[model samples]
Target: MKLFVFDLDFTIWNAGGTWCDSTHPPFAWKEGKLKDQENRWIYLYPEVKEILSELKAEGHMIAIASRTNAPTIAKQLLHMFEIDHFFDAREIYPGSKLTHFDRIMKELKVAKNDIVFFDDEYRNVEDIRSIGIESVLVTNGLTKDLVKPYLTRTIARDLPQSEAC
Candidate 1:
């Protein structure tokens, strides 16, 4: 019954060691690897698919919110990764993560209290948390272990921010 939001780029996948906007387009999936035109591999972090599937199987909503300048490229990568079916909503654009959440809330009709977000950027985590959404700051990558506790909860409320976290 919760809306699980995720940021692209470093949170879900790394686009050739850079943001999706910087990677050359016309990306192709070749030999089980997804790469841009320049042959730079755009890869999802390990455990991403497992956790996404786990959320979907449990009937929890899933979405993507990214500030990448290349929304089209990001979508392409998502599809190329064969994980596009996992998302219920997507707000991929260049702007504050707050804007993305606002649109997602309006579209999905979900309250901020029901949304648990994950993002690699500290600023984005702070932005979503300011609105009373529980957001996890993803540093290494997204993993099932990272989101397990939140999944078991019914309403994941906001937490007080700390410098150490």
Candidate 2:
């Protein structure tokens, strides 16, 4: 089985129009939205939940690879967003993307090619790709269509009846 990895900042949530490390502190769940002290709203991309749910339903392992300076804050945000439980593995420290994947590889015991990584940064995509992983660049935000093709193409053969993209 393939492990699906996503970057946190842009790939998972907008994080109040900035990185999670840059967001104001004392975040809370206010009226179905997550807002910080400055009232900047942090939210998941439209298709994030749907995409994650579909991947989980298809019996795929999901992971997070974030380069945020504040790993605690990032994990807090994930928990507050109620999506922390989705990630089977999390590497959320600011460091080489290579290291993140390396830890994940060791932890999950999956080969580099067994991972499908998504990130908004071109450098990250290239970095992960250099290690022979199947990486995709998430431009604006993650969408079902953007991820569907890659997800479907990779795992449909192993699935009983993989959903059409």
- State, as a TM-score between 0 and 1, how close model 1 is to the true structure: 0.89
Candidate 2: clashing pairs of residues: none
Q: Weakest 10 consecutive residues, lDDT, candidate 1?
A: 154-163
Give a tens-digit lDDT track for model 2, residues 67-117: 999999898888887888888899989998999999988998988777899
What is the RMSD, in Å, between candidate 2 and the native fold over all Cα?
A: 3.7
lDDT of 2 at 67: 90
User: Tens digits of per-residue lDDT for model 1 on 1-165?
Assistant: 789999998999988788889999898888988878899998999899989987887789999999888888888888888999999999988989889988999999998788899999999999888989998999888887779887753223343356224
The per-model lDDT (C-alpha) reads: 0.87, 0.87
Per-model TM-score on C-alpha atoms: 0.89, 0.90
